[model samples]
Target: MSRIPTRHLGRYLLQGQLPRKGCLASSNYTPRGSCRVAASCSCSRCLQPFSPQATRAVHVSTSSAASPADTPIIPLRKKLKDEAKQLKKESRKNKAQKGSAQTVDGWELTVGIEIHAQLNTSRKLFSPAATSFNDEPNSHVALFDLSIPGSQPLFQPQTLIPALRAALALNCDIQPVSRFDRKHYFWWDQPSGYQITQYYEPLARNGSITLLARDGIAPEDGDSVTVGIQQIQLEQDTAKTLAQPGDARWLDFNRVGVPLIEIITRPEIHHPRTAAVLVRKIQLLLNAVDACVSGMETGGLRADVNVSVRRTGDTATGRLGTRTEVKNLSTIKAVEDAIIAERDRQIAQIEAGGSVVGETRGWTLGSKQTRRLRGKEGEVDYRYMPDPDLGPLLISEDLVRHIKESVAHLPDRELDELVDRYGVSAKDAVSLMALDNGARIEYFYNVVGGLGKRLREAEGRTPQQPLDLELDPDLKKYAPLAANWILHEFGRLVTDRSSPQDDETAFEITPEGQCARVPVASLSELLFHLHQKKITGKVAKELLLALYHGNVGEAGGVTAAIDAHDLWFHELSEEEYGALVESALEGEDRVLKEFGGNKKTYPQGKLMYLVGKMLRLGPTERIDPVNAEKAMRSRIEELCGTSA
Candidate 1:
């Protein structure tokens, strides 16, 4: 039996190359998150390829006669039917060519998505059972989760805040009064034979998520596509069925009664990559509000995308063609790849004279293809009804107001502050704050606050107008120096060494449990020195390493950290620096012959390598390398000035 593959969400993504959005979504990506599972887990939900030694079931039907292929559920057009026959015949001699995803004979691929986001609450909804993942199977089930006799569900009001925060961040309108419904189902995992959800009266509606356009413009500054949010409904999740070491399967109700918010998007998406962009946006938003960790391997968030196609001339009001629902995509990359694959599958069918069937398909990571699960069911199949046991959920305007007041500096607002207030690029701000947890976020803002204070002190007031990141004159002075050290340097030091279960714990407090990771003063002092031209970029990086290793003095500041590390850049006398540079050219006869004898250009690398060695200033030395490098270039030009 093959074990399931999952993301090791314990270590956050701190090493991947930054993408277009500046989000480090590479392996264990902060955005396209990697699977994080323990060796003990045996769930095969991901369906990754197994080893040759792994047990797998393969059926071999020994039939002598030729059999027909599985009949396509959706019928084909006469023109397409003939094309498909010819295609099948040609397939014997040559492999089928994959259709171009961007434009398949003028068929426009439109997509919609439904996402399930697990809330990061302490306890499950309507139950006192804990909601931690990977607990011993069946340990967290409450009486309500098990649907025991005389067991009444009691709501946890705190869970509502994350839901509401997501609604506001996604630009959704909150419902003053929402009600719960019982969705009838008979899955073995659901002990109650139904699920409690807000089917009719949801917590919010009319929200929208914006995706950066992929094709025609720069991803950062390009025109964006705004997808409509159908609704965000609050719901109670069902238990998971896990296979035992042998053939037995057990219900792990640890997930039962866990709070979930289902975000359904309107079919406003066209490109396959656009679907991924939207999912990433929501994932980060959920991460921002602490609504969900968005860990796909552990089932914190999952996406179901519906893809369809129509003729090029079809108008926006035209009836939508047949669509296939590819369900249970575990990560942002999975969502993107699945949608693209499905779209191509549909195009191949049509170009070969076939139509698409409306059905539910499951993405198999092992094959990178979608397999038929079952026919797509309509709302009537779920048998939704008002829950008699639970009363209508009442959300007062005052409650929304109160929660809104508390997180005024939430991620979206923080993103805007970095952009409009501090002149940071939209992409850079996202890279700086998007996937990090609350404590790291707190540390992030404190660093930004320190910069803001310094700016105010220098200018005496906020600048009169907002500066775009490209045109901003002041960004080079503060943002680059401050944000780079904090996000990249500090992030790598912490997340790279964090555990596989929870990266958030790494920022909880110092190793001594006194407070969170390095205090703001440490960073403030470091930035102050850099801003004061007392240290070069090289020295700043050395100081950052010192801070990471706890080399700073307890009572002493960044200056003390610097002294202890001997990372000072010394100011060299012009005469001393000039003679030092001249000496680099004097020793090598081949170079000296060139300097006096009209050599077009000296060996820049060899001479600079030696120049860099002699200019190695002492520990307390404080020469600004930015200016020193410029001065070195001028002196080199004078040495080679008169073609002799």
Candidate 2:
């Protein structure tokens, strides 16, 4: 019998093919009684029979044939060099195509926003310390906030109300059984070494906000987009780290352990402007529901935006490109600017054949650019674990129902009311709702309510009588007028007060309401008189300014301001109006020569000049412009002896 060489046997095994039938042993061979072989063996090298112990000793071996010594091997350094060369080649190709219009136009942007809103609760999430915005740095800190060794967190149930209200307002599905987890991290601001948050299970999920065209955030007037809410989780806010001169950094633990609700949105936003609008909408909604303090300018609301770009038709993985997160954006403008800067950065990187690194970035307002902050951390890096000290946060169905019932009118619904019921233009409605965190809208509503009450009293009707502002012509005029005054004129007043000079002082409002600077009652009365034609538009503006400045003295409201300033519109008798018009045209030969005789081409400028003359002629300066213009036109036609 022929025997196989050890090298040949090993080669065959390495190749995963069995050896030939007779290579090891003949199939028909029989073992002698004393041989003790497991099977038959016919080989010259088999001096001893195979035993179970010997079978175990058999080793799987590799032959030189599997990997020859002549095969070329690349060193790690050389391999890296080759990779760098390939990257450079790709980068060159991308740079060559970068200038192509097609390349620039084919890219699409995707953005996801994660907003952290400080809860409007009085106490901290897990401590008894009070929650405040501008309090003394360390004054509000509790022992737990400082992370003392013996301190344990005592959960505050009251903080859940605002969180639940926010979830409901956003139309999120509340999780009946949610829990908190410990997100492990080390930072100077985080004294506890781990943040208590809802990681494993969030408080709510699967919500959506529909950005309507009328909301002024949509791409076009009639187009609308729906942004999906991924989840809303409750967490503890980290302390504020103040960067001082040089390397000195101070931590304000007052903010530590403060309650926060983190709202994460799906990557549905495409435009930078749209992302900003969505953030503004969220602010409006939260403000309307009194959910959180809801002002990005005040650090009550902060956002982290994840932005990515890919070719329009690229479907290789049916997934987005690598994303970079812009963290801690504190303003709506900053949110928009950051997304734009990050989106452009990714596009430029990709077009230049460089890949977008998944990392964290920050917006430098001065430069209007996004700068690298740190590499993005993964879930494993956070080392999330169920919080042993705090058990599962079980929410009762009754509580949810109560919260749902208590949720105030959301921004969208308020917008609808403003447009449909209040006769405000869509543009005006959006502007009104966004002002002062929806406080302007509340002020507008109060003004309208006051107008309605005054109208009811004027008509000798009771409060129960349904007085539709749309149906009542006099009352209907007040809606748009009030909207204009609050949005444009009143807004200008606030801006002027807020920025009176280069070094501005913060303007304080009365405790009555947001419109306490110009009391709503005063504004309502002013608008009412304007609508009634009792005061001219010019007089109304003057009164509005006076009211805002507190120049309107005690008790009489708009009337008092009007009387003190002698701003009441006086109706001139026909004779008195004719005499004033006649006096303006008495000695104006140049005006008559240029504009009076040509009735076919009655110059509007000439008519306006005459009207201005008549206005200046009046001592009180309270004549209505419309009435003045009419009186002047009639007198001019008589003088020209044609219908001028």
Candidate 3:
């Protein structure tokens, strides 16, 4: 038998590039040059053609004519196909493994988040230049921001107020003494050659946030995850870099030197949804405390997510697998999806006999995947050094105490209170808190308060006193209904009528601007009338729109609006209701034929259709849908011979 080099033999078999002659010995063990396996001929010694196992039995001879270096390179497509096959085989094996069904292909994912939120301040962090988001390019740049010679860093003390509020809101421990350091990096947008940031000593550290199901973040009801805050650092933002066509770029200094607060979280999140929820929770908390303008849409906030995956029972060295960081995830959905995509990518790489590389990646919305951006940067690469101009920051205990006192309850806490105090559902409470930054929540509370006062007055009790909704059943029943009206009816009306604005200036200039057209008292009166059955829900909605569009004057509140529009709910007598029902069903033979029977079941759709026809036959505002349905059901039973 003649021998061939192992590399040549394997490459030939794998690529199907075997020479037509003398590729393999025949079943009779002929000389190498006399046999061919490409045809029907087979080699008993090598088992089969193109089999990976055949490579092991083939012996390599030093006397072979071709050296290993002479072997042909594998094509990219072939390599990809082989990798895909390996990955699929491994996936199937994992599915068959013990406990695979209990986990994500028997692999666990861990994630940590770093968030950079721009502080809501009028001036830059170190320079006195004004800070604005949509201003002209380079208009807000200060001399110091330009990094000209002789320019010195001038620290702004006011920026710390919001930073301190953010730290307190996040439950971080405030550091009495912290200092700024220079993070050295070369980028066109960063003209200073380095960024002034709190590195060695951040503003705060070791805090935590508990995400509750009521907050609508957890995967299941009654599930709560408390993620620990690693640190909160004060930093300066880089200028905006816009890529132009043909490899050109535009730099906007309007965002240069903007104050930023970086909040880092420990690697505690195990699910993609939870990670996204944590980012959203932080944005809400910061917005609630007036700490930062956490608008992901406006680039006011950004998140970097670190994702890694490990086998369920892999305990070697008690270390986790290498992780990849997905950077600059602007939206909450992107954060969750990037983590999931990166996790799957790493798992697939590992399953295909490859190792996960520690690198930086970017999330592509078009493809919904994460692509490699660059290798991850290490601490040493930044070349951190203390800023020469800025000294150690010293905070007085009085200031910390004052800031802590000023910091109201975070969104999660407020959410809990809203659900527990009022009879509102968890879903409704979350919606209230999210709309217009709790402005709607306050409106809802005012409406509830007004209703409570009215109830007290009707009971001949103290009308000006506060009442516990939990103890008073009448007040409890109205809270959820009030939430529904404010969130659904009133909120929808205002949102549709109000023109979209580029910034929050309209909301900030007049906090009550959105709700000013329709007063809380008007909504309170409207909902009260709804509860009293003086008007149906449909009529209430009409009155709401009327009040919003100024068609009805707000001088006398919702009562005046209803009267002006003649939207008062009317109840018909039995005779009148029966006549209307008969007229509605007079010509509708198909509806009756399909649904008419002595069976107990009735076609709800056809019944409602008849009720709708009856409503259209008369003044809808005057007809209560409940009464109309009852009248229609009775008339149908009489005509059709049974109540179906």
Candidate 4:
């Protein structure tokens, strides 16, 4: 073997080509187009051993007939003329371990995301396979999903509505004419070997999502980052593949042909924290619009993250470092973790006189480094073409207008209403809409509406006004109060851990004894009683929990439920109050030692607390604490010369 001469390694990356060994001054350098792809390594074409030499690859010829400048594929080093700069990055992470922190100028971090949202449609995109989870494996597969000889996929017009709804909510420019293409790939999950997707012309494009700065992001630096949405396309879900005992592979086609909307974001996210926030915001929006359930635990929603780093101060401009594509991040937390880990890996590689290789990587939940799945060269070999089975989708004008009317309340809009219209505190508003459970939020409105009606009825006025209107003065007092109880106390009542009385696996239930949920109307009525002083706050909280759990038995209605459970506040009878006052003033002469038979030395406030405590042990009674104090003071004065 000839010893290789040392040289600056910039010529290997050009025209979408990676030099297998040439980029890193490898001892084994084969000229381009020399060999077949490696059997085990999974490189697209290069047979050389997988190395850590990272750089962008665009292969060009030095032939006299072809001009390198004509291709617009000029290597990045040519523009900057900095071989020394490429050799070493700022190494700020290492420096920060010492005392001083130095800001690394000229390096920019860029991130893009591809989100897969399972469409909440009745049937699959192409086949009539029932779109349900946990069904028998392969039970839901249709002939079209398996690509039978004559079976063809038929488009469901109803499924198009949901895809359009998400696109419109994202502020995307919906393309009236979009066509589907076939993405060819070989995997155990995809029996059809090609995925039907809108790629050549996607469903929507050129939209943006705005995320508020969070996780201690300083306002002076930037209060928010608006990442760009590149496109939103409708696609078909593939089957799930499971690795079994003895390294065996199992295929479950139950999820095949399920509809999905793929939202691709631009390389706008700079920080890992920002990427997490952006994905969370999009997930909430998808939930709000009913486009996806956004349940990472259930595999209903997932994201593919594209993270790249550059050497520029502003994230807006720079020649990017090689990026690693972290695939199939099921959780938002995992996305953030993977990005940070990949970034650190790239920075370390560059610092250690190696380049960051662009490749497909996987993340184990607790691990910090990404595991390589495949190289960038192999991953990009998915040859795409127009599908002969499908035609261009023609979205009518009426359809767009109708879909727009359907999605009236989105996450941002609801947050605004909670603060501006309902007078909910801004901080409280965010927590309310953060998850974007439309049903839960809608129930909140229903409960508020019920409160308004009940208050108006009490005032002997018609309860016909719109609940959206500023409620009657009587009900207005409970707006913030009710929100506090619902968001905090009542929320805890339903979602918290099981009590001693509850079963280990607690699920939603109702007081009716049927497999039903407690009605929002009933909860509102309970709150109404609390607001009107018919029940104490403590009674109200217990009452809500009682109804939520099975503690309360079956009843006729909301009022009946409260009465049946005896959750109403009880006022102390005059006899009980007098007896308590007498006991405190005259103590037990035989059993009580401290302050026994010493009425003149007893504090009036202590006597009142004793009286209240005795009452609390029995019932939460309304006692005019102030008047009780006054009466106690008078009684003490009458009994003793020194008590006053």
Greater-lDDT candidate between 1 and 2: 2
TM-score order, best first, reads 2, 3, 4, 1
Model 2 lDDT tens row, 530-599: 8878888777787777776667876877787677767676788778888888888888877876654545
What's model 4's lDDT at 206?
96
Off by over 4 Å in 4: 1-107, 213-221, 312-317, 377-380, 434-436, 465-476, 494-496, 499-505, 509-517, 554-644
Candidate 1 on 1-644: residue-level lDDT in tens?
65422332211232221222322221223212223443343445323554577454322222322332332233335547888899888886453332234445677888999999998889888998898677788877889899998998888888888899888878788999998898987888788888889989999999986655422211422587788999999998888877888789887889889999999999988777667778777877777666787456567888999999887877566887799999989876788778878887887787789888889999977455678899888899899999887887888888888877765555556777776756566766776554443344455556655655655556665554333332445654676566666667766766666346445445443222223446676777778777866677777776666565566667777887677766666677787667666665455656534445555766566546545645664222554444555566677567656321
Q: Which one wins on lDDT?
A: 3
Q: What is the Å distance of residue 497 in model 2 from its true position?
A: 4.7
Among the numbered candidates, top TM-score falls to: 2
Q: Which stretches of candidate 1 lie over 4 Å from their true place?
A: 1-105, 120-123, 128-130, 134-137, 149-161, 211-222, 287-298, 315-317, 364-367, 394-410, 448-476, 491-519, 533-543, 546-561, 576-625, 632-644
Q: What is the per-residue lDDT of model 3 for residues 1-644, given as tens digits with 9 covering 90 to 100? A: 76867866876766544543544332334444333344443466433334575424452222344544576678768888999999999988976742222137678888899999999998899999999887778888889999999999899999999999999998999999999999999999999899999989999999999888765553532478899999999999998999999999999989989999999999988878778888887887888898875478778999999998899888465678898999999888888778877888888899999999899999876455798889888889999999989999999999999889998667777777777777678888887876665567777777787777676776688643546644665656788888888778754764665555512322221234235566667777877888888888877787877666656664777787677767676788788898898789888998888666555666888899999999899777678788889998887777777664
TM-score of each: 0.66, 0.73, 0.71, 0.67
lDDT of 3 at 342: 87
Q: After superposition, how far is residue 613 of candidate 3 from its true place, in Å?
A: 11
Per-residue alpha-carbon lDDT of candidate 4 for residues 1-644, written as tens digits (9 for 90 to 100): 96543332334443533334544223344445544223233344443444457343322222322444465676666746665555445455554532221112345566789999899888999987788787788888889988889999899877887799899889898898999998889887788898999888999999997876432222322877677899999999998888899989888888888999999998867777678777777777887787876467678888889877655653355466677899999987898778877876776677688887889889989897988999874424778889998888998888888888888777877777676668777666665555334444555566777777787777777646544445444444666666776578756765675766545534443222122445666777887887777777777777777767655555555568667767566666666666556655554333223233546556545656655644454333556454445555555556543344
Clashing pairs in 3: 602-644
lDDT score for residue 57 of model 4: 34
